[model samples]
Target: MDIQPTSGSAGQTGGFAAGGAPSSGGGLINSDFETFLMMLTAQMKHQDPLNPVDSTQFATQLATFSSVEQQVRTNELLTALGAQMGALSVSQLSGWVGMIARAEMPVHFDGQPVTISTRAADLADRAELVVRDESGTEIQRLPIDPGRQELDWAGVSDSGAPLPAGIYELSVDSYAVDELIASDGVFVHARIVEARNENGRPILVMESGQEVAAGDIVGLRQAQ
Candidate 1:
């Protein structure tokens, strides 16, 4: 328990923003094209035979409208494709529910043992697991084996009492004799409760009440 204080959790929130999907301008453009057609027809009908509409100008107008319409159609297609891609990606992530993912982040201890993954410094002789509360105050420190990659924290404090269920920041501190050598943030194993697409990217909602980006997760496995 000879651990020094460190800058703890900043109470950052992990989340999703269900932004509204953009509207397609297809209908509006279609309506405008219809209006243009009507106007062109009216002009042609009202013009005297001796002063007919210039054919070149009429052709140019039609070509310009066609080009704009084509571009709009392409844009609509691309938008639809992007939506499909996002949905497909989320559908694949949906299977992540009920699985355990490894990521370095604060974990909510709900009276259950939380598995922590960490790496000790290369030259360290001793290591300790440091625990902090939601407010970033160091509350507990416990000895751990140097270079140990994984361990299950029993949610107990330095006083040997079960900690209340809440979010806690966890890390591993390495020391060489009297001087502190290095500190590494620890990754905790948490079960995925939900998966979603936020801003066209996959997001995982963990049982620990934290949301993590799929790319941030280092590992995944069937929940034990």
Candidate 2:
């Protein structure tokens, strides 16, 4: 499988100081500082000789600028960190290509038997695998060994006729004698054909053309 690395923008924005001037990068910071000096010089020159500007007020203005510059630097650092993490995530997902991932999604039957993986509820003595169509109609029920973790469906009807290829839902019903114990069927395994990014998240594309989030994968193994 040919897996391409996903590219994404870091979405870094320029950090502005208190006066709405950009304070990021060496060049921009120098410009902001020069602007500050010019403003301070003008203020000092225009001050009345009799009632000069308050020294405390000048100190406060300088402190405000300093705070803004620090905030801008912090933002730049965080942006760089975020970009590095995103690159690392893409690199990790690339390794998932050609591996079989177990998840809890609808089965895609394509001429071959579909392999399902699940576990019976605790305290249950028997398990039955229930197959349902797209319209929620129960088509077949097969007795399954409660102790087993994997089951293979031949994609055939009860009369031995081949079923059409499509997506189907499955559920496992656990029973103790005639009493229903639990209903659960959230497990299936499929080979990962490709890896892609969607909405800034890594998505694993299965051989059946289904897309699942990389984080949703419960188990993975080498594809045979």
Candidate 3:
């Protein structure tokens, strides 16, 4: 199957870059060690037999090289381990495909009723569900029961005419008598259509054509 690259947040990419794993430290250390050995051989060949080279200095230099080599190998091992972890993350995220995820995002209307899950403030007495179009114009307003966590939105205008199928936004406002207590965006359950890697992190594409980070998902369940 062909895989397509997905765009991700620039902030996330920057954070990933800040890690700065030393992927090439091993090769650089090996090159430097070869040069060190050549220089030591040349110095030995030119030294006088009477004076010769100091054995202590030679021992110290060899010890330093060994320490540097060990550090480089450790870095290489860490880099390999990071790669393996990344692969494992992708494999685990792949299991989310075909599952249902609940997230706070825009909804896509396809000429059918969409199920929206929302939460109201604990002290609120009533809640209102407001639906808006892509242009941010209010299209429908309905009083919702705060006790019921789920509501269905039929694609229709206030005049009982069907609205055009497209992306829309849903928000819930809680009221205490005449005062507005809390207002928050609503969440909806959508099937995971695909999973893609963005900046070494998993991103889920929903059936609503929305792309959200896996971390942003608040709930997950089996697809119906």
Candidate 4:
């Protein structure tokens, strides 16, 4: 359950350097703030009574320092909040493993049937399922009932033989007589094998090695 660094990340207070971020950084305003106070105290002590420091300018400088300090603290808070939310999201996604995730994307086939879900287009009288390989070459086309929303791709080619194990793209073409009307990618179902957080977003890794965003899931269901 450890989200040990999957990849490298810049330090937490990297961007806040120009603004004097106080968290995990050095030589910033917080450090400068102390140094500035000491300098100011010395200046006041050594100032000639005939030409004392101006009250108005001194107040303005203090106010500017106060504003910069507040800004740095705000950045620190935002970093903390982002971390908490990312952790919470990944923890929630842990339950998704062993469940089915339905999404619209290229599918990997390994000599097994892949379930494809489609949204039936009402305008077309005829529908055809088109399968393309990873190279974008059309490999198979089959007539399908226009009203059918789900089908299991048998991973077979036109030669009545099994297709090799690889990634394939699937889409449905809707035709109105001689005119092609709508073409939409179909949803391919895969099981979630692992879930991890990447830059505050949950990434679900499928059994096929495909990665899907947690928010991109079109449907979820228990595995049969």
Question: What lDDT would each prediction earn against the true structure?
Answer: 0.76, 0.77, 0.76, 0.77
Model 1 error, position 96 (Å): 2.8
Candidate 3 residue-wise lDDT, 1-224, digit = tens: 22222233322221112123223464576676766665556555554555555555555666666676787788789878877877777788899999999999998999999998888788889988888999999988888886548878887887999889999999988889858988889898899988877767778999878999888999999976
Off by over 4 Å in 4: 1-27, 42-53
In the range 57-157, model 4's lDDT, one tens digit per residue, is: 45555666677777777887898999899989999989999999989889899998988887547888988999999999999899888775888899998
The lowest-lDDT stretch of 10 consecutive residues in candidate 3 is 10-19
Which runs in model 1 stand beyond 4 Å of their true positions? Answer: 1-24, 34-67, 121-128, 143-148, 173-183
Residue 146's lDDT within candidate 3 is 68
Residue-by-residue lDDT tens digits, candidate 1, 1-224: 12222222222111111121122366787777776676556555544555444555555666777777787788889988988998898899898899989888997888989878878898999998898999999998988888767778999876779999999998889999857999888998889999998888888999767999998999999987
Q: Which window of ten consecutive residues has the lowest lDDT sum in model 2?
A: 8-17
RMSD of each: 19.1, 12.6, 13.8, 11.6
Q: Which ten-residue region of model 4 has the weakest summed lDDT?
A: 7-16
Which window of 10 residues has the lowest lDDT sum in candidate 1? 12-21
Better by TM-score, candidate 3 or 1: 3
